[model samples]
Target: MSTQPTTDVAPSPPAPSEGGRPSDGLQAGLKNRHLSMIAIGGVIGAGLFVGSGSGIAAAGPAILLSYALVGALVVCVMRMLGEMAAAYPSSGSFSAYADRALGRWAGFSIGWLYWFFWVVVLAVEATAGAKILEGWIPAVPQWGWALIVMLVLTATNLASVASYGEFEFWFAGIKVVAIAAFVVIGLLAVFGVLPGAHSDTAGVANLTAHGGFMPHGPGSVLTGILMVVFSFMGSEIVTLAAGESENPQRAVSKATNSVIWRIAVFYLGSIFIVVSLLPWNSPSIVDDGSYVAALNTIGIPHAGEVMNVIVLTAVLSCLNSGLYTASRMAFSLGERGDAPKAFARTSARGVPRAAILSSVLFGFIAVFFNYKWPDTVFAFLLNSSGAVALFVWLVIAFAQLRMRAMILRDDPSKLVVRMWLFPYLTWATIGMISFVLVYMLTDPDGRQQVILSLLAAAVVVGIALVRDRLRASRPATASAGGVRDSAEGEESLPTGS
Candidate 1:
């Protein structure tokens, strides 16, 4: 989410501002169009294209229930965030809310942990995108393609928010249209309306035919939950993007309010058509990946190549958003004095050049890891960042609980995107996330990953606590004296100051 100024509070220290260098003298260069597309694109991700296969395998046709359950949780979480974001609207989004509602420690922990998660994800997506490109051009090598993709995206992000948004808008538009077309064709095939279609394998019976709806039993549904939850991770990017928006409050409200229908159509709707067009137990699903296999079963020509192109687009889109999110989160941290002030500086177009460069550097390092020590480096990166989704979601829930009370006390009328059932539903969502985390611990496949992720969270939280202690122990003289003013004086102010 984009960052907003603190409301009705004394101005805090100004970290380096974006939009231009300290001497270049420019203002925040983000525009409304950039914000809107970022918000929309945030909700669609590569996971939807790639991860649904694992989910379907785990829960069979009943995977619909898993999506519905997770979708409901996301809607509730986003609504809670929307209410707080509309009132406060900072680029830090939930992290800032955590600071105000919970404590400085909560904000520091969540913000840094989230930033870490996305940077790692940037490497993952770049690798995935590179693998796809390598398939088309065998001579380039996967690691080389990974490096090239990261550099190109980093350049786009460093250019301007508008440039990044424009790129993402087209990327997201392609994925959205592709999914819609898939649903349409699948529905036609299910109803036996496609010209000369001879397959007898289409209809609702596909949901229950092979060993009934819960083929793997109720236990597997929990497994399905694990696969589905990650798909929802990108949806929260809207709140962060909203912070930079011209009308942050409105942007948050619209994005949060619209998320439900988007989930319904893009997620539930697409999966429904897939299952309806082919039996849940069909060999094609596990053999060819879910969506591609479904299309191929219906005799769609070039199904493999077609799906590969769509998946490639989805991967590239994810890589683009990952870079943008990592930079913005770093920028937010710098603004709050939680990170180096250099990260707070922006380019001529309001791009946080330092932060963007920092994230890209990590992405480059990851490409090296992919080439030199794929087993250890990539595995560690994956395991360490596994639980971030739960951590972030929990922060959102806690932030909303306090933000709701603050809104009620100050200006209840501003609660335009309130979560349903308020505190009750909020608590329930927390419980649900907690349950998922616990389930992850018990599942053998997820246990080590969860443990590693928890360790990463612990490390960040420890750093935050140490930082807070150091800040508290400092002599009041340093804070009250001219130390701050001297620092400010050494740096040239942005233009328009």
Candidate 2:
């Protein structure tokens, strides 16, 4: 008789589990519906809306290659993450996995780096959304709109996990619908089938019309990669959200199975339509957005405003998810002794109140610095965070190497989502990410982002080394009286080294 695999995991921790503190103290309030939508929505970020414009202009039709390349890279990383997460579900996600596979220091550095990344993202998304609102309403100053937007989302997150899930579900839905409609309508325009679509300029010819598909040559496609890759940043949020889902394995598996195609269609497919509908050199593309310009070509009323509203929704979705993710990671870190115990505490609604508030507080402070010195303070923060997503992915790739072997040594059945080509593809992904980081160093702007991020990572790593030393000397004090090895419950050797 054939046997089917099963998955029922007990969470993993950086240190031993303590007596009273829960790994997350999070409720299973996130429904399957919410999980699916969050997965779908998280893939579509505001970066695609605003940043894709720059990608198209730079790489022209060849930008599709950039998107596809990065999309494939994301697929490999996410699949590896899904594998570990399914076996050992944790709110900390990759950071927790890094701790188990690498070391406490590795986990500590990445956890804090990731939390820092999202907190910074919260500020960026809030600022972007505020600018759009302030444009619409003359009464509110930009800072006022920023404050209002951040507070509203913060309240939604603080209310309950379900409230955050519901808000993200709707926010992602709008982006999904908007992109789907844009693809359908834009494709028709390309083929000269849709009414009001200018077929004369919109067709396959547009691909070669300006300077040909490889207009800026192969090099631009690589540079386009730097631009296109960051848009895929939020895709990892799915596995993080899975910890709170009713069925974590199922949720992570589903998200892993489908994220690739979703990104391919939304990012690559959408860009294809834009390039097809108009020349890459079109002046209007940059100012109005490639999508907005395409809509204008078809004579849609208030096309720019319509796209702006959609962008705003994408921004809000990002802000909502960013806050939730950062807090959850902080919650996990606290539970593992990598953060303060207070952060591990949760309210009745299963919300990490201290973690959430701290994350939001940093976000608010970032927004303030953004206004005071947009060029200096906020720019440094942005650059420092620029490469963290890649760094996290790199850690995931390496963690999966050890994780996969360990899972096999323990029980392979729990790996519901397997990374393709195992060691080879895993090595290849690691190499590819390293290459991107190095490639960025060649450009002045990209170099700043990379250097700043590395400096930030180095600082975190130094802190982690000190913390690990302190923990080793006084484990009891570190975990607040003591921590029990859950390996007794997990029926395995201790995950910690």
Candidate 3:
């Protein structure tokens, strides 16, 4: 099979100025430290704190295998993504790669779907954060809190890319410190080294006792995958963000290389402590929530309140990143002529002011639906975007398969971050993603998400296809004279009309 793409590839936008603060494009304002912390912190989402309780209850200690399995999947996908990102270094990330490797239609479809996913995320995280703030101060209604939180983060994103990085650095810093402390403290209690303990079950015995590790059986472990898989959505944000860093390729390569340890430490490590601290079936696991329950079991004071503070920080971090990510994707789409031109323009500080505001405007609308129509409209929005992460990963895998050969044929030196096992592992990733999507049909909730998400994808793909057909039918005189200008080395367009 030919690895070369059959369709014409659009050129990449002009490179940022040498000053690293380009007025025409995004600025390289993110420091190495900012990128480092973002890579470290991106994997630690609020879902780990709030949603793991159900997974633990459903899969028992075996949930660790679920995390490990999904972690392995993400690692592979990121490797493939890193390979292309290192070579191309675009804000579009996989979407841009898809444009050159597959076709513009593929890029348009996945890019819009991904943007939809994050804007929906904006609403979900806003509500989550608002609830916490309301709890802290009842005088302010939850709706008011949501508006306040959204405005603050929107302002942060609009300030400059560096401001976003700085805020995320601290936000991610808090999450990292909190999780590290939890693991260290939990380990002390687990090994019986702590001065005081609330539960004697804080030992390895908790793993085997109460129906053994696989309490609900292997089937339950498969089901648990559905629960924990979405928590890994933000793992790819660093790749998109790399375009705004001082050294995009190096930042991307480093972040990709480190994903394994980050997941192993933050996700698997934290979950290990929770299950080990108490029986998986313990009421605390569900009642108090996983992390909070584990803390209480170890005689921690005000466990719920402590976990609340940490979860709130995680929520805010997610909101901050969601806005930044969605805007960047919109900016990339606009640059490629797939969206309005205003989206591609930047302010004096290299901020995509129109792009940021447009993305936030949609996020605000989603938030309104969330408050006004929680069950119907918001529910539809959530389910429709639910499976987008897997879709993005699948597109990335396919894009990498073609991109690897394209890079080898063009400039092999740019292959700084290569995927392991080449076509074999890439095929395996595609297979795994397909399996997850197919498996979703078995669970009622998962089935709805799969169906609606597919519907949403079909709509976007339909639009892209229609646009392509219309462009093709235009007079040759108008469409001719195109030139090959892609930094990624895509082929040239037709001659002038």
In terms of TM-score, the best-performing candidate is 3
Question: Candidate 2 lDDT (Cα, whole model)?
Answer: 0.83
Poorly placed runs, candidate 3 (over 4 Å): 1-12, 15-24, 476-497
User: Which number leads on lDDT?
Assistant: 3
Q: Per-residue alpha-carbon lDDT of model 3 for 72-167, expressed as tens digits?
A: 999999999999888767788888888878988899899999999999999999999999999999999999999999999999999889999999
Instruction: For candidate 1, report its TM-score.
Output: 0.90
Which residue pairs in candidate 2 have backbone atoms (N, alpha carbon, C) closer than 3 angstroms, thus clashing? none
Residues 1-497 of candidate 2 have per-residue lDDT tens digits of 01111321223343312221124456677888899999898889898988888888888899989999999999899899988887766788888788878987888799999999999998898989999999999799999999999999989999889999999989999999999999998888888899765547888798987888989999998999998888888889988888777777788889999987898789888999999888998988898888888888877789988999999999999999999999998887776667877787777667778899999999999999899988999999999999999999999999999998887776666667898988999999999999999999998889999999999999999998886676567634232224334211111222322
lDDT of 2 at 39: 89
Per-model C-alpha lDDT, please? 0.76, 0.83, 0.86
lDDT tens per residue, model 1, 357-408:
9888887777677667878987888788888988899999988887777777
RMSD of 3: 5.6
What TM-score would every model get versus the actual structure?
0.90, 0.92, 0.93
